[model samples]
Target chain A: MVGPVFTWIAEHPKVFWTAAQQHLVLSAAALGLALALALPLAVVLLRWRRAAATAIALVNVLRTIPSLALLVVMLPILGTGFQPALVALTLYGLPAILINAYTALSEVDADIVEAATGQGLSRAQIVRRIQVPLALPVIFAGIRTAAVQIVSAATLAAFIGGGGLGELITAGMGTLDIPQLVVGGLAVAALAILTELAFGLAERRLNRTRHA
Target chain B: MNWTLANYDRLFTALAEHVGLVATALAISLAIALPLGVVSARRPWAYAGVMAVTGVLYTIPALALFALLIPFMGLGTAPAVTALVLYSLLILVRNVATGLREIPHEILEAADGMGYGAWRRLVRIELPLALPVIVAGIRITVVTQISVATVAAYISAGGLGDIIFQGITQDFGEKVVAGAVVTAALAVVADESLRVLERRLRAAQSERA
Candidate 1:
């Protein structure tokens, strides 16, 4: 099993490299896009309890939709390709990022906010100097969750021509090609573990800075 | 609408298979996680070790795990269930361990003073107290597995995913909508029902307190 996979890797180094690169780019782009949309929306939602509640409820429903379904459901609407895949993956990532950001901001110690208010910090200044720093750890935790999840879900993008490592896995399955399957599975698994560990270390650092 | 009416039988069969797949995997996961969780809860090193192993298993992508299993397990419900069970362990075990570990020391002391042996105390008191958290974990596991199990259809483990995959390949919008809708509904129903059970258990615990 191992020998065959290694031989395949050696024979088609470019194919393996391109798939790995595509997987990374897809995962990264989705995480980046999710953060961009979710964070600002989370900030806005923080000030509105009713809207936050509704948005979170909607996200909860969205979360129940299977990742594959979410990807393919985009076919009719967005058509197949990297763009649709990115959109679906970003939506997959939204819940954790949005919920965590809103909760982190809202859960900042009320007394501290009061002190900041008394100190005459403007709303924007308080958000920048006080709320954001304190919320960073929790928000980072959410980001870590989103990052790991997005990486995993990005594999499904291959089914729709999103061109990720999933293509290798799917092709392997079609042909019962053990070498392709092993290589693809191992690469995706390695990427996911690496993402988890990287974010975990960053999260710990954030916590330490918060404490210090 | 017309497509769904024409294919209701297919839809129902897929939904049933999806439910069965999730149910069987969850049952096996709970059985394994409960004992492991209880044992690990009492031993910090064991907890860490078990978590480390399960965490890695949980980190692997669903499709990747399924792909890896195909050569060994062969495609079908078995490999799909195996993957689902593995994915669920991290969530269920962590929650179970945490639940058991969170029981107040004073409560355990009182149980001991009442002449309850370790086995009896666990069954009669600690497990009950921990029920809410365990149920909460089960809720998450079910919802997540529903989604994962849908993807299991790619391996020919029959489910609503079969319908969705067919729709994707055929470019049939109605089939995709039907599959997604039913899958989401199953998830929501499972989640809400487990949530109710969790809430009830919490209420009972608080009342006892």
Candidate 2:
């Protein structure tokens, strides 16, 4: 099994590289889009307590939808390829970041905010200097979770012509090439683990900074 | 609507298979995770080890895991259930351990004062208190597995995912909608129902207190 995997990798270096690159790009783009959308919305939602709770509940429900179904659901609307895949992945990634952001922001210490205000910090300045910094670690944690999940889900992009490591697995399955499938599976697993670890480390560093 | 109505029998069969697959996987996962969780609960080193291993397992993508198992398990419910079971262990074990570990020490001491043996205490005291958390874990596991099981269809595990995939491949929008809608509904229903159960158990525990 090991020898065959190595042989397959050696034989198809370009294909393997392209798939890995696509996987990384798809996961990264989705996380970026989700963060961009979720963070600001979370902040705005903070001003409306009822809306925040309702939105979070809605997101929780949405999160129950499987990643595959979410991805395929996009197919009818966007008609396949990277555009649909990214949109689906972004939606799939949103709930974690949004929920975490809302919780993190709202949970910022009230007394501390008052103290910052007492220091004559303007509302914008307080948010920029205090609230965001305090919320950064939790938001980062949300990012880590979304990143890992998106990387895993992005493999399904191959099914709809989104071109990722999943393509190899599908092709290998079609051809009954066990080694090829294993290689693709291993690559995807490696990417997911790497994303998780990288974010874990970054989150720790963010914590250290916040504490300091 | 027309497409779903026309394919009602097929849809129902697929739904049954999907539910059966998830149920079987959850049962096996709970059986294994419960004992492991109990043993690991009191021992920090053991808990750490169990979590480290299961965390890695959980991090692997469902599709990739399924693909990896296809060769060894030969493309059917066996491999799919195996993947789902592996995916579930981390959540179930963690919840069980946390639930057990979080029981107030005074409560355990009180149980001890009542001459409750270790086995009896665990059976009567610890597990009942931990019920809510364990059920919460099961709820999450069930919802997540329901979603993941759809992808199992790719490997001949047969579920609503088959319809979604078929729709995508065949350019049939209605099948995709039908599959996606039903799958989402199943997940939401499972999550909401379990949440209610968890809440009730928590309320009952507090009432006992």
Candidate 3:
């Protein structure tokens, strides 16, 4: 099994490399979009109880929709390929990132926020200087979780022509090519593990800094 | 292109298959995770390793995992169940261990004072107290398994995903919609039902002296 996969890798190094890059790009785009929106939105929304509750409820509903269904749902609206693929993966990632950031920010000590306010910090300053730093560890944990999830979910993008290692797996399945299946599966799984470990380390480092 | 009564049998079969796939995966996962969780609770060192390994496994994408399994497990139920059971271990283990650990020391002391032996205390008091949290974990595992089980259809494991995959391939918008609606409904119903069980456990927990 291992020998065949290795030989396949040796024979088609470029194919594997390109697929890996596409997978990374897809994951990164999804992760980046999710964080860019979820982080600030989490902080802002938490200030309004009704909005936060509504947003979170909607996200929960969205999260339960199977990614395949979601990708197909996107097909009519976005017409497949990169845009729909990114949208689907980003949606897959939102709940973890948004909920985590919101929960972390909500958990920031109220007294600490009050003190920062009394010290003449603006609301934004209190958020920036006080709320955010304290929320980093939790938010980082959420980001890590979201990142790994996005990487995994992005593999489905292959079904939608999203371009990635998923393409390899999808092609393998289409052609009944076992070697392609083995190489593609291993690559994506390795990517997920590496993402988890990398984020896990970052989380530990952030935690140490927070403690120190 | 359109939904018809003719498809009902297929849809129902897919739903049943999906349910069976989830049930099998959760049962297998629970069997391994419960004991492992207890040992980890007793041995703090084991907790980290167990958590890290399961956590990594949990992150593996379902399709990729099916890919990895195909060489050994082959297509259909075997690979699907193995991948899903692996995915479920992390959450279930954490929940059981946390539930066990969070049992207050006072309660255990009281159990001991009542002449409750280790096994008796575990079966009678500790497990009952931990039941709610463990159920909460099971709820998460089930809902996720339901969702993940759809993807297993891609590997010909036979589930709601069969409808989903076929709909997409056939460009049958109605098939896609029907499949998505049922899959979503399954997740929501399973999630809410387990929630009731979870709440009932909580009510029982709170009633305990």
TM-score of B chain for each model? 0.96, 0.97, 0.95
Displacement of the residue B137 alpha carbon in candidate 3, Å: 0.9
Provide the interface RMSD of candidate 2 in angstroms, 1 decimal place: 0.9
Model 1, residue A54: distance off in Å is 1.2
- Stronger candidate by DockQ (1 vs 3): 1
The candidate maximizing DockQ is 2
The order of the candidates by lDDT, greatest first, is 2, 1, 3
Q: In model 2, state the lDDT of residue B2.
A: 96
| lDDT by residue (tens digit), candidate 2, A1-212 | 88999999999999999999988888889999999999989888977898887899999988889888888876767887999999999999999999998899889999999999999999878877998888888888998999998999999999889999999999999899899999999999999999899999998988887688
Q: Which candidate should be chosen as best, given lDDT against the real structure?
A: 2
Ranking by DockQ: 2, 1, 3
**Per-residue lDDT for A1-212 in model 3, tens only?**
88989998999999999989988988898899998889879988977988989999888888777777777765766876888899888888988889988988889999999988889999888888888898888888889888988888889888777889998898888898999998999888989889988999989988998798
Better of 2 and 3 by DockQ: 2
Better of 2 and 3 by lDDT: 2
DockQ of each: 0.72, 0.84, 0.70
* TM-score, per-candidate, Cα-based: 0.97, 0.98, 0.95
Model 1: how far residue B158 lies from native, Å = 0.6
Instruction: Give the least accurate 10-residue stretch of model 3 chain A, judged by summed lDDT.
Output: A71-80
